[model samples]
Target: MLDFAIFAVTFVIILVGAVLYLYPSSRRASGIPGLNPTDEKDGNLQDIVNRGSLHEFLVSLHQEFGSVASFWFGRRPVVSLGSVEQLRQHINPNHTTDSFETMLKSLLGYQSGMGGGANETVIRKKVYESAINNTLKNNFPLVLKLVEELVGKWKSFPEAQHTPLCAHLLGLAMKTVTQLALGERFRDDTEVISFRKNHDAIWSEIGKGYLDGSLEKSCSRKGHYDEALSEMESVLLTVAKERKAQRKQTVFVDSLLQSSLTERQIMEDCMVFTLAGCVITANLCIWALHFLSTSEDVQEKLYQELEDVLGSDPVSLDKIPQLRYCQQVLNETVRTAKLTPVAARLQEVEGKVDQHVIPKETLVIYALGVVLQDSDTWSTPYRFDPDRFEEESARKSFCLLGFSGNQTCPELRFAYTVATVLLSTLVRQLKLHKLKGQVMEVRSELVSTPKDETWITISRRRKHGEQQQN
Candidate 1:
């Protein structure tokens, strides 16, 4: 009897040890609170699906687990920081690259030597940043021309016509980003429409593919996505090849061609810029217009700021900085829209957050959307009040999340300038009004966009400086 008991005890110990080794729970990761893997292979993926999106998942996780939480991403464990305090502990401004780049690259399935190593990443990052800066500085006139074209289209519409705000802005943003980032080839309507069609197909699939592994499961869907992506690549390749042969560097693509980057590297970075630039710019402008439509006071204040800054002249790049109230409105729009819901950084080495030790090489998420809406961080977090940003502390808090300052991505900086030019030009000439009984619902994915087509009406402003009646 004693011998039998000893053998049974030894067998149970081995089995338990094997189980723990194969599946380490969140408790094993740290003292932080979070969900464990529901399935041995899937981890918390099903939970993410149940919660709708990664953004929504983080929202619920932070709500339940306080400022810091941990959850398994397949076999990998992810730590999410959802408060300014948690972010401050984790962010190192000196670090060259961030989780946003890493995550974006993964989602796009971009395979290149870009960001392959520390030194390569730093060099490429600088070139990419310079490209955007040069494009914006050299191409301000092009931006104005595009904005003017959009304003002209709006002017041609009937006074009470219900305008498709999201669609119109998306097309405008695509045209602006494509022309500025790619080349004047985008100036042709046929090329722009073709590129936009391919872009929409690819973008629509990317987020859904990343979340559910649906692309791999559905062969037809994956094939269509690849076809669209191939078309986009073809367009970029032709443009890049053309730019390489040209003597003068004119647009964003020209900057890349002038660099020592390989053709593949150039394509990778340009793809990043083009995809992120269009989506972010379009959604930012959409939310800005939607918010403006809902608030007449905000709209009037913005117009007054524009009037004071430039009575009848258009928004110039130099004049952009002087429109402080306009900047606040954009800042508030980003905050309220939660434009980018989440960004992640791989923990280079083991790090500490408050009392917890983050594992080395762990994927650390900056739950930016949650932090943006945190009641502790903002007063009446749901309110779309631009006045809140008038305070220095509010701006500082925003900068910490990588929305502003040196940390802002190249695309975001470019988008802000484009948005400022577009908004300032539009608001000065038109009175924007929301359609009756139109309820705007947010569909938060890689970007936060309206769930349905948003419609608005516009009336021309009088030359006497009087606001037009909606």
Candidate 2:
């Protein structure tokens, strides 16, 4: 027993000594200039393992460390950026290749395949753009129809009761996006519904596991993710098989079948498109509605804008560009809420910025939540102010919220359209109000949403006679 105890103590001492000697921090007493790893005092390390809440930790680091700071997740070194200018510099097309997408591939356990070579990346971008154009052209009416359906459902509920904005938005987004991307044949099909539910469940688990630093220990989550992927592949494969049999060519599945991508690649891309669109679009709409409920003035202003442009007629794709304030509101909501808060990347080559040398293969993170709210970049950062985006200069700076440049999300165009159409329809027809004295708490999981599920009482607007009576 004495010998075993002595051996264990010696082993621990040797292990600690080895870690101290070989760790990246040990190799250099000080980090490269302009970039230093966040210490324990900044709450960097603790944030990773804490119950999946990273917003406060990230905000604290930015307040303390300025734009660039490094931190460790176990043995992995991560650098976080808080400035849009610095993030833009790193994401320049000339400098890198789809950093976040590459990181996503690793996270999803897909083969990198030479990081989707430059040519392939460019092709994919064009294909994605074409897909967006096709989807909007073919499905805007369907999206509006879904909105109408939701509104009809809302009207049936008692005026004293509030609708579950988050769940309703999630269901609407899933139905609309699935119908648009996969076509009506699979829209409400049992297999499709099952695939979506299982995939969403898995993704939610994976996101929670990652934020909690328990991704490796989440065998159930891993199983769910793997099962979801397999089921998704089966669905897409069936679609491909059906399309081939009918000699019919639709946009998404047909495009995938014709591409040089393998079966797995096709499945992954399809999954990314379908699942990402649902979560992001749904969350964005939910947050927008939540804010609108709290800010009656903003909602009235938006209604006026919608009235001026849409004029009580059913919304069409052509009128989308004319709803300028609606667009701004969505932009501000995304900026304030930051649905996709932090994006991670790995430096593929050694790069120099200011006084620091970022070594190759180092993990870099761009905290959109921090950068979007930086005092230097935004005025009245905490306020829900859409007017700030009315100016050209402000809009230009706001472009960093991921709609322009090479780093932009491929589905952003689609997301914007979906959100605008839905918001315009709802605000124009419904009088939505927050429950009295109810404070909606923001919850951060895969995305930020209201904690209590964004309960809001919505009623159809009266046709002037009822308004006069009131």
Winning model by TM-score = 1
lDDT of 2 at 324: 87
Per-model TM against the reference: 0.94, 0.86
Runs in model 2 deviating more than 4 A are 1-21, 25-47, 93-100, 111-116, 404-407, 463-470
What C-alpha lDDT does candidate 2 achieve relative to the native structure?
0.70
Best by lDDT: 1
Model 1, 1-470: lDDT tens per residue? 99999999999998899888786752345657788878677788888888888899999999898899988887778899999988987886326775566678777876424646777878888999999999998999988988898899999999889999888889888988999888888889999889888888888877657665557778898889999989888878888998788755878999999899888878878888888899999999999999999999999999999999998898888898999998899899999999988887777778999999987888888899999999999999999999999999899999888888888877888889999998889988888998999988888877898999999999887767676556
lDDT of each: 0.86, 0.70
**What RMSD does each model have against the real structure?**
2.5, 6.1
Per-residue lDDT tens digits for candidate 2, residues 348-389, read: 777655566678877777777787777888988888898998
Clashes of each: 1, 0
Candidate 1: residue pairs that collide: 99-344
TM-score for candidate 2, please give it. Answer: 0.86
